[model samples]
Every structure is written in structure tokens, then in C-alpha cells.
Target: MKRLVAILVIILILIVLGLLSIWRLSQDMDVYVSRIDTIQQSVEQKSPDLSLIAQTRQDWENEMQLLTLFLYHSALDEMAEKWLEVELFCREGNYSAAHNTLSLLRQDWEQLYFQELPIPQNIL
Candidate 1:
């Protein structure tokens, strides 16, 4: 019947949209991961660029405004805390601690990134 067809169409559209969002978010996450990698490299060099730290955090905050629409806040909570620690360590010239925090943050980011992929483990 017409009602049944319409419902099926709507469901199909929702599924397609969900797939698109996952693909787009995964791409954005890759950018975020690379951004952190650059910061870690800079910190490893003993430069401790507070400006870069501030800029990256600012960029992340700006992006989160849109990202929040699709992501659960709980998933981001730990990374948010780690980011603050990274900023503090950089400001205090504690590159070693910053490096460690970045590693932890990287793991958190990877967990989020992989969770969205269309892998067997994630799908099954």
C-alpha cells in the first residue's frame, strides 16, 4: 500500500543519511588525528608551542559545535580532559608529560574513529 511504500522510503533515506554521516565524520576524525600528530611532533622537538596548542584547541572547539549534532558527549569527555592536560603541560614546559598525554589522547581518538568504521567487528 502507499503507506507501506512511504515508510520504506523514509527508512531507506534515513539509512543513507546515516551512512553519509559516518563517512564524513570519519574523514573529519582523520584530520583531527593528524592535527594531534603535528602537535605531538612539535612537543617532541622540545619547542612547546603554546600558540599551536591554543590554535588547535580553538579549532577543535569550533568543529565540536557541528560535531555535537551527531556525536554523544560522553564519547568525547575523556579526550576533552586529556586535551586540557596537554595544554597545561605545554604551558608549564613539561614536554614529557605533554607527550604522554598526547599518546593517551591519540588512543582515545583512534577508539572513536574505529568505532564508526564499517568493519566486521564494529558492524557485528
Candidate 2:
């Protein structure tokens, strides 16, 4: 009887662990799905403001020239800055502008970034 109880306890613990893992995964997936939905809605409902993002990109590119190469490694900050600009563009009734900002940011990241490229990891 003791052995059976021990086995049952172990099984219960495993079941609990499995349930927790699945719950966590579901929560993460929900966030990811919500964020995707937001992006899709923004794209479909609003237009992109290419001009604004382009201007911001140009300004950043020029500013990058003034900074030393050593600090260039801080791509995370740049990525965040560009992301915020894109979000702001989207908020200002220019989905196209946000898309443009994201495009330029992606280009900059591809060309000048080497560290783990930050791709807005927010789930929502």
C-alpha cells in the first residue's frame, strides 16, 4: 500500500507540473495571438505613413554617424527607439507610416546590427 501511495504521489506531481507548463504556454500563446491581431487590425484599418517613418529613419542614420563605432553595438536601444516610432506612427492615423518605420528599422538592423536582433517580442 505504501508503494502504491508513493507512485500515486509522484504521478500527481507530474500531472501538476504538466498542467502548469501547458497553462504557461497557453498564456504566452494568447499574448502572441493578441499582438498579431493588433498588428493585422492596424494594417487593415489604417494606412501606412511612409513619409514620416522615412524621415525618422534618415534622422537616425545621420545621428548614427556621430556616435563612435564602440557604441554602435547597442542595437537593442536603437531597435526599441525604432519600434516606439513605429507605434507612434500607427497611433497617429498612419499605418503606412508605421509600416515604413518598421521597414527602415529592419533595414538598419540587417545592415548595421549584429547582436540578437530585437523583433518586438511583446506578446500583446
Candidate 3:
């Protein structure tokens, strides 16, 4: 009887551990998915504005701040490339490019997400 009780306890512990592992994995996956959705929404809302590019360029020129320039340049380049691709896709009537661009943009977001990984300051 004691042996059977011990086995049941062991099984319960294993099940709990398995559940905990699954929960953690699901949580991480949720974060990645949420970030992807946010990026895609942002991309979809983009308007092909040369003014944005010009403004960013002017900011870089006036400040001589390498970090600002680097970030704005990189984002501008990506946005422009994606915008052009989207225009071409629209001309060709291919809606798939819009979706594909979202995937590509998600990859960019993923890279940034991993680089500046957020940590919860306080656990509620």
C-alpha cells in the first residue's frame, strides 16, 4: 500500500512539472506572437511619405548624432524598401506581398525584441 502511495505521489509531481514547462513555453510563444501582430499592424498603417524620410534625414544632418542617424536610417531604409515592394505588389495585384512583408517585418521586430529583451520590474 505504501509503495502504491509513493508511486502516485511521484506521478503527480511529474505531471505538475510537465504542466509548468508547457505553461512557460506557451507564455514565451505568446510574447513572440503578440510582437509579430504589433509589427504587422504598424506596417499596414504605413503611408509612403517622403516627408518622413526627409524629416528623418534632416534630423540626422542637424544633430550629427550617430545613434539617431543609425536607427532612423535603418528604419527608413526598411520602411522604404517595404513600401516599394508593397507598391509593386499592388501594381501586380498580388496581395500576398503585403502578407509576406508583414512576415519580414516581424523578423525585424523579433530581432529587436531579442536584443532589448524586456524584463518585468515587479511581479504582480
Better of 1 and 2 by TM-score: 1
Which lDDT values do the candidates have, in the order given?
0.75, 0.53, 0.47
Residue 31 displacement in candidate 3 (angstroms):
16
Give the worst 10-residue stretch by lDDT in candidate 3. 115-124
Per-residue lDDT over 1-124 for candidate 1, one digit per residue giving the tens place of the 0 to 100 score:
9999999999898777666656666667767888888999999998867787777777666655555655455656666777878999988899999999999888877877776445333432
CA RMSD (A), model 3: 16.4
Task: Score candidate 1 by TM-score against the native.
Answer: 0.70
Between 2 and 3, whose TM-score is larger? 2
Report how far off residue 27 is in candidate 1 (Å). 1.5
Expressed as tens digits, the lDDT of each residue in 34-97 for candidate 3 is 6446534543555333443344335323432332322233543564465456445544545566
Q: Which has the higher lDDT value, candidate number 2 or candidate number 3?
A: 2
Residue 61 lDDT in candidate 1: 67
TM-score leaderboard ranking = 1, 2, 3
Q: Please count the clashing residue pairs in each candidate, in the order shown.
A: 0, 8, 0
* TM value for model 3: 0.33
lDDT of 1 at 97: 99
